[model samples]
Target: MLDQALKNQLAAYLQRVTQPFELVASLDDSQTSREMQELLETIAGLSAHITLRTDGQDARRPSFALQRPGSDHQLRFAGLPLGHEFTSLVLALLWTGGHPPKVEPELIEQIQALDGDFAFEVYMSLSCHNCPDVVQALSLMAILNPKVKTTVIEGGAFKAEVEAREVMAVPMVFLNGEVFGSGRMLLEEIVAKLDTGSAAREAAKLDEKAPYDMLVVGGGPAGAAAAVYAARKGIRTGVAAERMGGQTNDTMAIENYISVLETDGPKFAAAIEAQVRHYGVDVMNLQQATALIPAESEGGLVQVKLANGATLKARSVVLSTGARWRNVNVPGEQEYKNKGVAYCPHCDGPLFKGKRVAVIGGGNSGVEAAIDLAGIVAHVTLIEFADQLKADAVLVAKLKSLPNVTIHVNAQTTEITGADGKVNGIKFKDRVSGDEHLVPLEGVFVQIGLVPNTEWLKGTVELSRFGEIVVDAKGHTNVPGVFAAGDCTTVPYKQIVIAAGEGAKAALSAFDHLIRLPAAA
Candidate 1:
């Protein structure tokens, strides 16, 4: 299944495999099982020191479990190891084949000290490049400790499981069946969650009435920047966000941010978090802001209610909740999501290199995705629902200049088509011609629009027609002492540097608000 170049790379990687490892694949009379067998056989064929076995009948399903000299933990895969998960499979096999876990003693001690039996269920897409780090981390723990077990479920393979979990994205870690963290997470974060016995224990220690000089909501680059700026002013600042990374974590490649030539979403998000924590900013994660209770007067404490029945108070608040990609919601879209249907082209585009893919929507994002993928993939087909392409003339001309790109306007994406756990094509209908057609493509990128994360802020602060918070040049919202920034606000272009600058302005504005406060009672 691998090309000559890829096989050569694999050979070099497996040269140090001195210990023998066995890949036990549970097979059945199913096509998925057949595909899984082919993938495993290809890997096992690369090294003479490795062995493969097909033992149990799993009906139409297939699973993999690794066994070797040192590891006895039951780390299993209920889904095929492909896409972003292929790396996890390789890393798992390599570790069992005697590649000692490359980790710090402190991290090893933390994993060893984890007391309870924890099951780390990681949902991943085969196409996500960043997912391997998270998956390998948890699996490494299972390999080292007997108390911990890891289950790798390919999010695209198990559509029903993904739906039951209400998962919309990859690298979603469920520690004990509860959503512990999402996006690109760090090892210390896993250990930190394990340190807390239960969510109840974590929530029970919070003081809802404790006031802060500034509370920065949202954990994206904007919110993190605001917290850092506020903290530097020597005021009590707390950052409450649904997830610490925001939408920035969904991006795969970023080169536009100033002073940084290149970076990925996960790395940038981690950098933002590290900076915020380094400044002693109190960060409350996994807490959704449900409503805003405005302060009665100047210098009065404002209450920020959380989804978990907790009300946090702050003298001022900065809203930086980011936006999410608008899904097409067509049939097979939810079912085939991450299997072949994707949202972020920057994140999942590289996975489709040298393969044909489809882009739904023809706005700037769609045109940009087509342009980006054209350079990597072998062919590109762009489908637009509107009568004419809505992208800028320059972008449209650039797209036209690409020989590999094919654009179809006034066409609607009807369904994403595939079988046996993968996407193979798409079904669409023409608005003008009233004709239906199918395009053979391996992946789909939906770039319709961005819906701001401001539903909870309705009627609280002044909002635009699209529900985005109204903010001035200084990030000040309509309400007194309340500020907003990032994609959730009226910022013209939603970019990392733009949001970060807006956040800094909001933080400075908030500090100025604090300085002019009335005398303390």
Candidate 2:
């Protein structure tokens, strides 16, 4: 299952194992079970402290459990943990074998102190970039505390179970048989959910913090750049974001990023976040900012209110809240989200394998999604509201050449039709004839565009008609001590490289504004 180079790397990593562990696998006469056996054998051969047992009585065939001798703490994988989940498997092995994890000491203690039993089942796709974080987080909890157990189920490997649960998305987490969450989640966020009082404690801590010189309100590429640039100026800096990676975490292939030949969104986001942390920036992830209160006096601290009821004060604020995927907002769309209506093709495509699916929009994202889904799905129906496809000529040509793909231009998506609590078709109308048609499919992929996450700043700052934060060339907003950058601002192109550059510009502009402030009383 693993190549020679990968085997060598696995062997090297296994050398850190200070305790003995076992890979107990339940197998059957299926091909997947055979492959699982080979994989377990290969892994056991890599380390002296590892043992393989094929007599596991797990009901799920082709499944394995990583367990320490005489310890109830365990982590299980019901399918091959390759692709993005490969890292999760490696980390589980290391952590189970007494190798130290990189998480904070406080978080480790919290995991160990959890009270109730947590049987976490994460349904994930191999192509999903966001699943590893959740899988690894739960695995860490399981390895740290005997009360926690995690089972990562590969969606592609067990299609019947996925369909039975009506799971239409990757990284769909279930706690004790009920749905817990449906997307990427941070380790801290998971613990915060389990430990209810953690939020109150964190809010109190944040309220006691001193005012920062520069405070960034997002954790995307733009926010990371802004935080790093500000911290490098020898001034106090802080970053508050709902999620550290933001929309970048949802992105798939990123070949357009300069310097780097090719990479994925999660990798790029992790790299930038590491760089920001390297500069000693105080990053508070999973903190949602609900309101912006400008300083009462000139050169005073700007108070940013968080959803947790804590307010952070900063002399200069960089608003890089970024953008989210634009929803179709048609009828049944909301009711069927993750019930067959999904925005991410890379993450949800595997769930609809050999099934018909529709892609809404004709731009690069829609066209690219169609092309990628054509291989996994039985058929791809591309719907565009414009008269013609807005994608590049090369991409359009490639899409047209696909045999299983169909294109519909000048079509408006009216509603996503579904029954039995799952999507079944999509309704659209042709602009020329005003004729409405319904395309029968099992899934709908919305790739229209992005809408700025400036809804909270509607009354606080000057925004464009399209709801983007109005910013000058220097990234300064209408507010005196406030600035905006990236997709949330008036930037023409919403590219990662452009966002990073704009973030730097906004940081520099904030610094310039700070130096001219009058002496505080």
Instruction: Name the top lDDT candidate.
Output: 2
- How many residue pairs clash in each candidate at the backbone level? 3, 0
Residues 406-494, model 2: lDDT tens digits: 99999999999999999999999999999999999999999999999988887999999999999999999988899999999988999
lDDT of 2 at 29: 89
| Candidate 1 C-alpha lDDT tens digits along 182-267 | 65665656776677653455455555337899999899988999999999999999998888888877776789999999987777
Q: Pick the candidate with the highest TM-score.
A: 2
TM-score of model number 1: 0.70
lDDT, model 1, position 378 = 93
Question: Which residue pairs in candidate 2 collide?
Answer: none
* Backbone collision tally, model 1: 3
Candidate 2, superposed: residue stretches over 4 Å from native: none
Against the unseen true structure, what C-alpha lDDT does each candidate score?
A: 0.82, 0.93
Model 2 residue 378 distance off true place after TM-score fit, in angstroms: 0.9
